[model samples]
Target: MAGAINATDASKRYAVVTGGNKGIGFEICRQLACDGVTVILTARNEHKGTEAVEKLRGLGLSDHVLFHRVDVTDASTLSSLVHFVNTNFGRLDILVNNAGVIGLVANESALKTPEERLLNMMGAISHNYELSAECIEINYYGSKRMTEAFLPLLQQSKSPRIVYVTSGWSKLENIPNEWAKGVLNNVESPPEKLDEVVNKFLEDLKNGSSKEKEWPSRMSAYVVSKAAMNAHARITAHKYPSLQVNCVDPGYVKTDINFNTGKITANEGAQNIVRVALQPEDGPSGLFFDCNKIVAF
Candidate 1:
């Protein structure tokens, strides 16, 4: 069994939040530190990342928060994060995979007001092949890299938890591709199978047969990448029952991902993600939580 676990011992806990410079990710970092957990708030941009740490310091969370620059898509950056965690904290208690991309382009100047954009979330953006690939690489593969790299450090903890901040688009029904849905549905499927499903979507996208292939017509890359993340979450849980691993939809929060067009505040969204992240040792694993309730994949 895991060490006699206690969630309230925040001072003894250490956590890492990816893309933590702003938005929901920043909120996640703040709340975790408020819980007394030491948090590493990582961002791709060094200046922005350090500035965020300073902001937390202003909040008097300076003792609980620090900064690191990590582009999840880059293995070396992740390696550096791994080394820092290993050498200092010696273990990892929680990891929040909150980084993501909208997989589309939009002219914010031309965009309607946030209220209007909220009403037309799907219609507000446009997609192309390059952004499509980048989304998959970062959203899906990036999380995979983080998990694999941190496994050793995580194992050093008495209780390790991973929270995959997926999306409502991750719902299988949102993906029109039935075959790809089946792969995600297969709890017995390996990580390679998830990789295959994502690759298929990319191929269809490049050939312009994505629609004909029944892939998600809108937010194609975002939808597919998140679904893949959800699948890996399930696999990780199954493979390591001693750990708490789960996926969550943090709600549609107004952040940069949506051009600050979402309806909910970042705090509201981070609340749900944090709740799932701080689950106790014996808590359920390999499940998808929407609004803090377990829901279908």
Candidate 2:
């Protein structure tokens, strides 16, 4: 067997954050790098990614910060991330699956008053079949893909941790569909089963029966996707006893997803995620956190 690692050795640890160009993702990368962990800040656009890294460097975080391009929706781009990490770092200690979408379009032109726009932005959203499908593809499947790709490297570390950036919307009570809630709430539920629920949600929208089927009428897809992401975090923790796989619901923060109407700042929202990602060797796994405290999934 390979020798065990010294959990206290911070210099050897490394992390990769998806969608790190802006908002919460960017803050996570900045904070992690500040803590001495070599961080790869990934973004879909190369120029934006480099700029984000440069901003970090300007703050004297140049020693361990780097940039990479990754579009969670593209398979080849994801594979490239895996290869880059493997070839450069050889192993990974933390993986933050932060890339996600709100799954709804804003009709800014239709609204007259800023209050009306802010109200619409802060409130629930309506989604279509295509929007929901893509939301699931990225928010849920994209996280899954990134996790699977980095699992080997994570296993090599003594204190491997996976943090899923979920939301309070992931709570079962928010999802009106009892069947979907039951599947996700079951701690032993597998990924295949979660996929089944998500697929059915898209099908419901296609059949024009989303309301009749009991999906959340507003932000249905986004809610379902986060719920599924939470479930996957539980499943992964169960499947990997050697690793600490946890999900965190970073409370509503002012970011692009919520159109800057949130109560907290991105840095405030990222603190909990960073906490989960840097959990100790014996930290709790298979758990969900509403920021810093462990809560039900």
Candidate 3:
């Protein structure tokens, strides 16, 4: 197994982190760059992306960092990212899908809370803010599109890894049995079917009918989206045996996503992600992780 590469050897490695302008993504970029990898910190906003690059530059890591304006939901922008990577690096060693959203009420709603749910309901409530204009478009579909666009570049590398930053909120045990069965049943099911499920979820949320008893109890769009992402990672790993693809929940790090009320620091949250990203060729693939341990899908 190839041990972790030092900064001097990092120039030979290339990595990209989506939504890397701030939070765990930003820290991941810093850690990766510190190890000498040429890291691309991508964000939807060009100004923010550039500013993030400058922050790293201030720390004397500018030589190892680059900024790209990328919104995962925008197909054109994603294509451009692929082109940029291909033109500049020729191959990609790591791709981190760190961008995501929480679109549901994280409150202590009598309707949603379980008898003994372990997560902090108050913390979840505090973190559950309003959705963005493109939260759904970017959170689930955006990550999927990114994987599709970058798969080719990743294939070119001698050893490639894709890490999907997921969440504990996405546990399948919380999903409705019917919907969960439909998605987790077979890998051969059409991809469009997954989209349909998500669409139905949104429709239910919009129509106020999601409160029905049949609906998944913890059916936050964000949770389902991350679950779908994890499922997609499994499918992708099965499809491409050469690539190492896994999903992880970086245990509640304090970031803008949670309004900075998390228990873990951004650096601590990013460690597991970086560990998976830098795994050797024989590392586990198509697995889901909570913190560092592999979790059941």
Candidate 4:
């Protein structure tokens, strides 16, 4: 336990949602708050995060919602969050890792309509080593960092939950590199081994051998990162039997990630994630969810 366990905490639940300034992330915060859980709405941009919290407060969730600035890719920010939780709430009951990037570098002016954009995104967007590396850093490693930092605080809770907002692309089958896929698909693989797999992907990408290596040609980093994230979530669930850890693909919800071309609304997508996050203590763990249904990882 990081701080003196508050007597009042026994009856109260606390949650933190990353990238909570917009889209599905923002909705997750709102829904969790509505569910009676105190929520820390976090974002890399302080102004946006503050604005989001104010909006939630305006919705009459002032007592349940607050803003915190965090950049998942930065360890300092994560440490700061850990300190804040330890000092204030004393324990963390829920953590929703929703911060992610699409890994596509597109020319906005060249992109016309959502229909055409969705159909021809691959052709219009470009992928480079830097962007690919950043995607992996934020999507995969960033989630891992948040999990690791909060594990101690989470352990203090009677019922802890960890949700990784992954994607359907995270399915191992989407990873064309059989060797990489194999490593990630093996839930028994250690975290270091998973790191090695992601590192190898980056190495191959930087060397311009990703094509020869049989990795995904389009949105390669996004797919690989989410795959790694799903694998890590499984491993984490097993490692911490006291915690409910799961990965969720909230369907293709319409948000900025896909140029708002996705089919469903952000609220619909977030409900799927919030449902998993609020699963009962006896609920199943180490599973991949496609919206409300459990699917293969």
Candidate 5:
């Protein structure tokens, strides 16, 4: 572990970013560090995480960045991270849940460009129950666990913030399943409602009833998980008024997750997220932003 934050750094803002080894997450760490916020760049792989930190350090941000291994799907790692942050920084000012996986398997060779893939996503990609389950586990539940584990430390901060990297496809209008949509769109619904919606989707998936049940036929899990993530952010924001919690769709950046076929750069996408994470204490909560503009959730 790196040295504990000293008294001279007591007034600095501290952040923990999941999946910080590459792409948008990496750029998020860089941007935050450039802004003078102390960042703990985390990934499931220690080597990659450390290397990313070193890269940032090489840019003369040695004092602003560090690395810690964190697998969001694992409870022990999450717990360890919570303890690490509490011990080192005393409190966490920002938590960016940037880790996610696309549930669909794409035939990259069939598509030559980002525009091609975006238009013919259904024909190019296929999804299975296993992949769908894993998507929900990491994208939705992983973020939930991170938020719950860090809530105590966040509450201690003077300007706590939580930023979930969601997708534009997660908008309520895109969800075909009315039941799941209702549960998610209802801000009054309890957190348990999210579990109900997720469990139902998995069950339907396992039983081969997803399409018949009106769940998205292509990229179903990615859409559902992000939708759930957005809903969870709303519930969390309402439950914890002191925290500035928001979801952002980073505008399809050219990241590995999308086979580097996106329209924008990783830095551009990360800028969207970093903008929300560094919002002032008086900033709005429980809102979704498409890039930098506020949009309906």
Candidate 6:
């Protein structure tokens, strides 16, 4: 049996929230610390990470809060994080893969004043945009790398849990094929097969062939990435029946991802994530949740 730390005796559980410097991730760290969990709030920017730690400290949760600089796309940084956790906490109870990007390329022309456009001979860039290469590199591959790097440490815990912050935009219905959808939606399928499906989808995207006939309803890159993540979570749960692994959609929270156009507050979004993280050992695994309720993949 894995070594288990008594939450009461230890005074808190240890957790790591990625991209936790701001928005929903920040709120998640705050809520977990409030619940007496020692949280490592990770961010790519050291200054931002420090500032967030200071803010959490100001809120009187410093004792349970720590900041670590991690760029999920970078392997060395991930190794450093694993080393730090192994040295300090000895075990990780919760991991929230909340780091993500919208992938929408901004139009530089939109930033210029109308008068300036009139004065210049050059035409303004269109408001409509497309996803960037960097977006896929970070949002999709970065999340996968983080999970892979931390899985060993997570296995060291008695009640390890992974909560993937996915989105409704990534539903299987948007995948557009019976076979492809079946491959992803099959919760009982072998991990290798599921991986093959995800790889095919990514390959199609790279070949500029995906979404040509029937495009995904929402942000294409974001949706596909989240779907892959949800599928991967199911595989993890199946592979490690003792561990609780789940994915969830925070339900359109007011965050930078949508340019602050969402309906819910950051705290409300964090509630669902925190709830999943704190689930009991027998709680549901390999499930997709939306605000505590199970939702379709």
lDDT of each: 0.86, 0.85, 0.77, 0.88, 0.89, 0.76
The residue-by-residue lDDT of candidate 5 on 189-219, one tens digit each, is 8888999898999898898787788887667
The candidate that wins on TM-score is 4
lDDT of 1 by residue, 106-208 (tens): 5456556765554354653335889889999999999999999988888888989999999988899988777898888887897899999989988888887
The local distance difference test score of model 6 is 0.76
Q: lDDT score, residue 64, model 5?
A: 90
Per-prediction TM-score: 0.92, 0.92, 0.85, 0.95, 0.94, 0.84
In TM-score terms, candidate 3 sits at 0.85
Task: Give all candidate RMSDs, comma-separated.
Answer: 4.6, 4.4, 6.1, 2.8, 1.9, 6.1
Give Cα distance to truth, residue 3, candidate 6, Å. Answer: 25
Q: Using alpha carbons, what is the TM-score of model 2?
A: 0.92
Model 1 backbone overlap count? 0
Count of backbone collisions within predicted model 2:
0
Collision pairs in model 2 = none
Model 2 lDDT tens row, 1-297 = 101222434357888899999999999999899888988899988989999988988999877788778988898988887887777777889999999998876668788755567566436444656877999999999998888888998998878999999988878888889999999988798678998999999998898888888988767888899999888888888889999998898888888787677789999999989988887788999888998877776
Clashing pairs in 5: none
Better of 3 and 5 by lDDT: 5
lDDT of 4 by residue, 83-154 (tens): 988888889999999999977666566767876665565653236878888999999999999999999999
In model 4, what are the clashing residue pairs, if there are any?
none
Worst 10 residues of 2 by lDDT: 1-10
